[model samples]
Target chain A: MMRGKYVIAGIGHTAFGSLPGRSTISLNVEAVRNALADAGVEKDIVDAVLVKYPTSHFESIYGQKVAEALGLTPRINCVVDQAGASNIGMIGYAAMAIEHGQCEVALVSFADNPKTGSRAVFSRSRDPNAVFGWFGVPAGYAMVARRHMGEYGTTHAQLGAVAVACRRHGAQNLRAQLKKALTIEEYLEQPMMVAPFRRDDCCLVSDGGAAVVVMSRERARQLKVRAPVPILGFGQGHTAWDVAQRPDMTTTMAKASAATAFKMAGLLPKDIDVAQIYDCFTITALMTLEDYGFCKKGEGGHFVEGGGIEFGGRLPMNTAGGLLSETGMPGLQLVLEGVRQMRGEAVLQVPHARTSIVSNQGGVMHTHATLILGQP
Target chain B: MTDDEKAAALRPPADPLGDQFWQSLKEGRLTFQRCKHCGNAWLPVRSECPRCLEADWAWENASGAARLISWVVYHRAFHEAFADRVPYTVAVVELTEGPRMTSNIIGAGDPEALKIDQALRLVIEPDFGLFVPRFTPV
Candidate 1:
């Protein structure tokens, strides 16, 4: 079994937010270099390189491009695209590749310059729906939020609580992009970009990159790496349907993903010490909490209220600000935070956190991946 | 130019696979694919049945009956073409035949009044030179 056999030996990232002159490739290479340094290893140790394709646009042989820039001729090199879920999904793939003897140490990285490069890519009209005036990713989540509200009386204030918690954590993190602490009243006061979702409910537009070094525990010990966080479990689930066609908008594939991860780890949700949930939208976080089995389905609104998910609360979540407050570079940052929490080196460390779980979802909850990390 | 003329100029790029569905809209009918083998139905014009994966499917005309599953009011238009149309309602409407499609809920005096599962009637109207299907409260 791959469980507990693989570990994230190192994590690294570039300065988030606007980097006007830097290209996505440079950001990716820099992040990889830092990750290798953090692991106390040279570039030669990494034989496999998997990268998430840049989200703003597409490029053929993108993973090879990143690998070529890094000057690595890895045994296995390719791009993984599961939207936001690609980061955690790459870790899982790397583990399988190691087990199959395809590669030993793998480097997984993602870089995007959506903020300064092409914010318009996200705003492009969707097929068939654009004529109906339906546009943007937030609208899809807003529709889900509205349905959740109708079905279970989820309130805007409850969503505000999620934003408040992430921003509160972000305020404590100097590295975070939007670190201004937000109150519920302030969140509610923000202009509604989409009905049921205020500006505060949305994640930042960031131009940044993140990378992680995944290697076997045996390899880490051989290299004498410090503080290698063990990968207890990893799983992925995808709905593969448009939001309108989903069987139920309130529930997501996270349910299946979490179940698989928990089963593989042989640990329940209650055993988790900290969680770094993908918070592309406040509603996404709220819904994910429910699907991950932290709270009963339809009760997520009540679960996150009153500092419930804050650092000192019952379950500290998104300890590094998450996509909501951290650099909105997608899911890899959360995995980085999970590793730090497991290593007890987090800036906003959850005291005595032994086990940390992270989630990455993409495409309006169409794809989901769960990673359970723990102190080795 | 008038607003209607300007709106009509923004047509969707042609797709051969969806020609029949679009043509049906121009003919004042809404059509969805129904699997002839497994009795499944779906929207947005697919070649095969999503459920049974059967190539045997036929276009079934909708009866203009549907229900609002969920909706969002865009306070800011993502597309520059829709910048002037901010504060518009986009919705997921489930047709009686079991296919759900993304559409707009028109004729609602106030979008805030919209509720899940509200009864709606199909309204085929001119959009970007095509009679696209939309919905309004019955």
Candidate 2:
């Protein structure tokens, strides 16, 4: 079992938001350089390079390109794509690789330029459904929000609560892409781009990169890495079905993903001190909390209301602003925040946070990954 | 552009496996696949049964009966072809025969007037170059 045998020795990221002139490769190299510096390790020590393929576009030999740009010839090098769920999943794969003696000391990273690149990719016509005018990722989530509202009496205000909380936390984060604090009334006033979702309810389109370095606990101690966060547990689950084909909309793969992680960690929801649930959309966060057993299914609406998710609430969430307010470059950033919280160095630190759980979901709830981290 | 040209622009590229379903619409019928082994049914054309993984299946005609499962209103068009079609309703509807597909609800004066499980009937309307399936309140 690889459980608790691995440590995330370093974490890094480039500036989020609009970095117009920088290529995705440059951003990736910069993030990897920062990660190497953070881990206090020489570039030659990295024997494995695992990259999450860029979301905006695809290129052949993507991982090798990043590796070449970093001037490394790692023993194991490849690209992983689970959409937003890839980063944490890659970390889990890295742990298994080390356990099997395939390679040690893996660097997992992701970079994208969606903010300045062709965001039109997100709006492309989905085959079959495009004829119905259904386009863009938001419409899928909007449909979920509408269905959630229909099934459980989830209100628009309840959904808005997630946005308010994330943005409020983001305002304190100077590096956050969106530093503006939002109120319930202001959130309600935002025009609806898709029914059941305003712009506030959606994630930011960000141009940035983030990465983490993983190595065996023994190697981390040998290297004397600063603030190595133990990878207590990790797991992933994928539904792999279109939203229309899912038997139920409210429930997601997070249930299976978190179950495996919690089982591996021997922990429960109440034991978690802080969480960084993916917030690609407000409804996703709400539904994920329900699936993770943070609250009863369909009661997530009430669970997040009245500052239930903000600091000092039952469970502090997205302390680094999450995808809603932070960089929307998929989900590696949330892992970084989890690392920060476990190390007691987060910008908006949760008091004495001993356990941090982070979730990464992608493809309209089709894929999910869970990671549980603890202070080393 | 003429109405036919605009509709043709919206036409999805042809698919060999899905041709029968689209051709059935052109012939004034809506159809889905039913597994010969498991009695399972589904939409948008697939090679094998999703439930039993059996390639043995046949096309079954729908009875022009369905119900609204959920829907969303687009305030902005994501596709340039839909630039003039903003503020439209897109929905997921389940045929009474146990197959659900993504479609649009038409003739519902206000989209807000629609509700979950509202009864609907199939309407094969002419797009620019082909007949497409849509739904409206029964």
Candidate 3:
């Protein structure tokens, strides 16, 4: 619909929960097939495929494995390995490829089965150094929360508010993992994975897949389907890979990516209609809220306290429920949800949603990617 | 056991991804994966080049020297494993080779003393049975 910009023609997502019988290939194929059908585009039209997943711990070589399953083997493809930010980066790459004529149609898909006997925690084999030999992501993020509390006086109550806001949003999402409303007292009372981080503060690990079909601006028009949402801008940044090297555990690298995306889109934090920030943990959103320039630094704790992320807040975020409450399809689920919001087809649709920013943080306290999408 | 043996015990077991890296650390050398095609090196080695998609690369050793790019100090331990190491400092050291690495900052009395761009040298300590590379003020 828009000239000189790539757009998302269709999206497909698998049910976000545990499925024992479904293999990773089955999940991916289902999502890709449905996305192509929804876009009314045939599989032959897909010029490239960008598949993303954290496969270091998993044995499958993501790109080749998924390509073969899709029956599009040997097609131009690259496995993005930026961790949770993988899908968002793939989205940006697909858009740029479509814009540059390198690929006319690209399908980006991500899926992970983190709930099983799978090593959702740090890989003892991949990363042996440091203190996290046996620790998992919860412990890593808990360390971050502890540092935030020590420096900025962030409280567990404030932390619980993040879970509460996410739960409130999740209540509206049929696909969310935990939909029950949570109060501060109840949240604090939940079992502690680590001190200061309750079980509710951590995200649920489930199995699911998300797929998006991107095409050239011209192709979108030729299809004569629903008007597509355009990719306005995107950016990626990182502070350090490990938790120990992070400058301020509270100052997320999302700030760098957000600033770049805003400048590229010729917009600011004030112009966006909605946000789908990665909330692998409740504290992640708090740090992202401050880093994205939505609120001043250190005020993230307070900003989220009054249910600001709920409907009619300063900015409605994670409307489709986030990884915090939504299915743990990693953060790619958030991107799909962001596109749904921009299209005004969201279940918990924000009124008059025009522009949206989706962000995902990959790895431990490193690798941030942001994409700004809009309909203009 | 002697201090040398104790330090050696901290090193990780010989695995495909960490064998060479651990060996270099035992020699007080900081090693990383450098893509032959893209010339971009990365820590936490990958099977192939993230930029060029080339699997042809080698483990290039370094002088165990760098500058502190940035860092953070954690006064509270989030993970049960890091409980005793509260008030520890983590840093991003810019290697002489064009990449940065995430490692712990040791041999410092206070975490607040770390500075940006401070000269640092590698300190490979034995953690359990794995040899982990850390950085200390040079």
Candidate 4:
């Protein structure tokens, strides 16, 4: 278990929609500058920077270029590439860095322009699986949803519950990509991207950036930071690199990740006051809820029904609208929203939220990271 | 088939480890490698046996019998290369010999008509110029 010694001293997010004028670097710079302002800490004190690995890079110079651009020259700086799990994964790594005395204050950030630039984020390894008719994330997820349907009777309407909730949440956020509220009728009526996967059931592609400043509780106290959201614990796990080889289509690594995070934090699923589960797809969010032990296995489709995940529900989830309604910049935005919830600053604030959890699923549902955050 | 389809049908990316498997498929046989030391069989041709980490293995031809695990009918094309083939079917099937792989399941008139665990047989079809191993309900 951690000593609860690290805090997200500040968090920042830029408008999460299409803006062709912004490059990845410029967007990240804005996020970091805003984070510095929020933390009331000078940029020079930032001894490390952790960012999501750039898939757009033809070479592996991703970490070097971003660190140099941010002027976060330090002995410790690197890219965290657990995919969607990278955001929370990086937070855990930053905490470990502080514990190890590597650096005092670390800037964790991510920025992408997939909508305006080339959407080359999918597989490029050209593995046997890729060439063997793998049709990208949507197709892979559709297959998963179909299997879940056969095994657990998960229905499209149940998945629609997640979509409707995220849309409602997004409507409250000025920075969300798709702010229009969604109805179950509209969700079911949307054209199919693939069987069991309608267009509205998937997250939108957008350009945006988000940042969080992490430092040891000791450092935050020394700097006299305001409302530091201490990271109680975090855990990460992976099922497979090749999506085709996953042992179970309905289960993800989120199960193991959540187990470890909760154990380390001395908390339970019932202890979380709010959750910002990643919502790359409605089915994904449903599966994550099940895997995270919020509900029984194969019961996620039901757990989300009847406004279960909507605001004012027993367990309000994805309060920022998630990737489904939020900007599709990736998973760090979930961490940002969780931090805001802890600080009582979220746009869709969960009343008196004291403890929060953030979950990120990455790759073709390959990796998972779960974090438990709370007010110090 | 178009040039792109022909190229798409070609044995997946050139690799010594996968060459034998693709070659066997092109020769009208669906073969998966089995560990020479352990007897663990796997698909998509890996370099070493996951069971024993043994690099020594041999390609063994299958009985061409399989069962459908899951499938998807794409109504939207994520890649331009597959755009012309919209609404095409892709399925994951476990060979009776114990290796699962991805391929098109032809002869199922309606994609929705296919059922999980349904019996399927191998069908080697020419795409563009490359030979691709597909499946049909038995």
Candidate 5:
């Protein structure tokens, strides 16, 4: 098993919405500043930096780009890319670096300004091979949702239930871009972006950033940062990048990753107090619940309809608004929200929340990454 | 772009790597992947031969035969481009060779009609475009 004694000293998040004036670099700096302040650690103490950038569309060289912006360029810095899992995976790298005594303090940050250029679901074209020429990201996810409904007798209302719950949670979060409460009725009436996925079922594009600071447990005590959350476990898996190459759309490789993470953390789905499932699409969250073992196979829609994720329900989720309602700069905000619940700062905070789980699927439904955080 | 123009544009431009793969589809030939060095049979085409990393390879015609391994029916289109084709069947077909290739299984869209280990033959869709190497029950 992997060994690490690293702890998250502080986590910070910017408002989850469009900030047209904020450059990607500026967003990174803002998040880093807040994280450092929260950590109560002097900037000079930060030994190294890890930055995640999905494409050159956001930043040219992630390490140098974020370093120059944060004035930490001279310090040891490197970039990490596992596609959309970069943010969550960087947490693992940052924690490892501190555990190895390679760095006393490691700052991890990621942000995107989707508005700078039009980056939407439909705008993206297929790869050159053209085997997947018929569909894009949304189509790939749509296929899975459709199959789930056909196999399990899941209804559109069940899908709407997931969206409605997230919207209810988002309404309480001032930082959420789509804070207005959404009704299941309104969700059903919303225009369809792709069949089985209404406008509200999909995440909003946003311009924002998120950051977290990792250090040794000893350093965390000295810093006296509020309720330090230990990184309990992290797991990652990938099957294929293209939709055409995937064998089964109904199941995700995430199931295996989630199982591995549970085994490492010595925790089960029922042990989680809060779940920040990536809500790129409402169906994504539903399928992830099943894949993560939160519910029986093909029972995620039923589980969601049972109100298991609402504020007062069995599990508090996306307490700060999910990617569906919050700013959708990839899924860094989901990680930020996990830390929020762990720190008891969530608007819909679970009572005595001490443990939380965060998930992210990058490059369609092909890549899966998860992280478990607990207040020790 | 017009549908024809879009289809033409969608077609991969001639390249040293994958042009031949696309070229064979246009000729309605089900190509079999062969190792550049050992001349062993391969299913899915790769940039280099697994046996020898040799970039040089030739495209040969196959019997266009395969068997269905698994399938999923998509009742909703996820993108505007696919909205018209709301429901479709996507499957992984095990070719006679070792490799398995993913493609749409057409003819009867119902899940029961699409059985596992069912024999299928590749059918070329010329007008609908994209040289879809779809499968029909043999």
Candidate 6:
């Protein structure tokens, strides 16, 4: 089931921060049109529509709503949900649709007015088991960091390094919300959102949208733009929905998800030139690096400490400033950044980057997605 | 009430699925479901056992002993009910019977009070008319 069958033809996004006047529809319209324009494809040619699941209380029947807003009657349309990991899942589904002869061109879009929308937790209903005190995403990730610290002796300074690195990259990203520089000491001094996680360690709460166009490699070659990024590998992994039920809090389903993607692409971890691993919190990023085999278990601290995760280091991660500093649009931006890197268009490009991988998670590290992209 | 106010008013409501668990806590005992067929124990009790997927199960109280796995101190209040209770500590404690739960580590409002593998004893406290299980160092 190797898939050179699909390629990401184009990517587009809005200014990725708090824009008070924008609604999800308006944002989707802008991103969708930009993606279509970038792909050099007409709106009518995109016969399928796929979207990421929103944590927003303001939107519903997202795919159909977006399709109507754009005035396109796609042959197949739907919203995919893996929480924050839905971006890769949308791409995977789009590829499946093409392979099945369902659609020739697919438009994948994600938009959320998180900054303007009402705030709430990820869970729709509270589980009695979490009655004590669950502070949403921050708390969920803090427990993970605490466990890793207890088991592997990971330090707060090690977590601070992730925040510092993301901000360093964000400072160059014009579209990023928080473009200011940060040192490990400054990151350490930020207010603690939850224990083991400071305010700087968490991703920004922003309002924005991003979209990508996925089509067959054959169609991509026919376009006027340069060669599209090939969908070398894409896969999803879903584990326990509740944190208490997770087999191991330190490790996530990314192990299985990344293994599938790598096997499909016939590539190894060393082949990746850049990564856009999700950074909801500094700990999740560190754990994702470990879980995805970027480093040995319990060595993520050592792996990222020596200016290693920065642009010029061993593995340039979150080159789009990630969810941490760029925008909290979650999974979609990771894919957008991956495509940007492969196209040599990243603001903080990893030199000669031809192959890349992006990962995003949902729930309390419950669902995971790993996608690999390369030269057409 | 406004939307935020309504959202703030909502607390962790017990469902029928976990009714037995809530009741057991009210009785000053921490109980979990054990499958009669395969002898596997689990918490947040489901109708069927997870390991063997059998509906045949029995309720048993834990030894009230657990080991501290990890913990966090929240400096932000997520809900209006907890607005005044900012900067609280919540920990994951695994029972000696082999099930883990998210509860508070009392007297350890400070994250430094937590130690991995430290022995802790279970205590039940009433919150919003429901008795919830919490843990503290032994």
User: What is the C-alpha lDDT profile of model 1 across A1-376, one tens digit per residue?
Assistant: 7789999999989999899988899999999999999999999989999999989989999999999999999999999999999999999999999999999999999999998899876665667666787777788889999999999999999999999999999989989998889999887788888998888888999999999999999999999998788999999999889899997989888999999999989899999999999999999999999999999999999999999999999999998899999888889999999998988888998999989999999998899999999896
RMSD in Å for all candidates: 1.4, 1.2, 7.3, 1.9, 4.1, 2.6
- The i-RMS of every model, in angstroms, reads 1.3, 1.2, 6.6, 2.4, 5.3, 2.3
Give the lDDT of residue A180 in candidate 4. 95
Please tell me the TM-score of chain A for candidate 5. Answer: 0.93
State the fnat of candidate 3 relative to the true structure.
Answer: 0.06
Range of the 10 consecutive residues with the lowest summed lDDT in candidate 2 chain A: A121-130
Off by over 4 Å in 3: A1-4, A54-61, A73-75, A120-126, A130-134, B1-11, B14-138
Candidate 6 C-alpha lDDT tens digits along A1-376: 6467789998888888778988888898899888888887788888999987567753578789889999989998998877888888888888988899998899889888878775564423235534576657778788889889988989999998898888899889888999997998787778777777888888888889899999888887776556588989987778765776665778878889999998999998899999998998888889889988889999999988978999999999998788888898878888988998888888887889989999988877889999999965
Q: What's the distance in Å from true for residue A296, model 2?
A: 0.6
- Residue-wise lDDT of candidate 3 within A143-252, one digit each (tens)? 66766766677888999888887788888878777777777789878755545567787777787777989886678888874757788888888765476434355677
DockQ of each: 0.77, 0.79, 0.10, 0.57, 0.25, 0.60
State how far residue B137 of model 6 sits from its true place (Å). 0.8
Number of residue pairs clashing in candidate 1, backbone atoms closer than 3 angstroms, sequence gap of 3 or more or interchain: 0
Chain A TM-score of each model, in the order shown?
A: 0.99, 0.99, 0.93, 0.96, 0.93, 0.96
Residue range with the least summed lDDT across 10 consecutive positions in model 6 chain B? B1-10
The DockQ of predicted model 3 stands at 0.10
Which residue runs does candidate 2 get wrong by more than 4 Å? B1-5
iRMS for model 4? 2.4
Candidate 5 regions with alpha-carbon error over 4 angstroms: A1-4, A54-59, A120-122, A129-135, A150-153, B2-4, B34-44, B49-122, B127-138
Candidate 4 lDDT over A42-94, as tens digits, reads: 99898888888644443376767877888768667888888888889999999
Against the reference, the lDDT scores of all candidates come to 0.90, 0.91, 0.75, 0.83, 0.73, 0.83
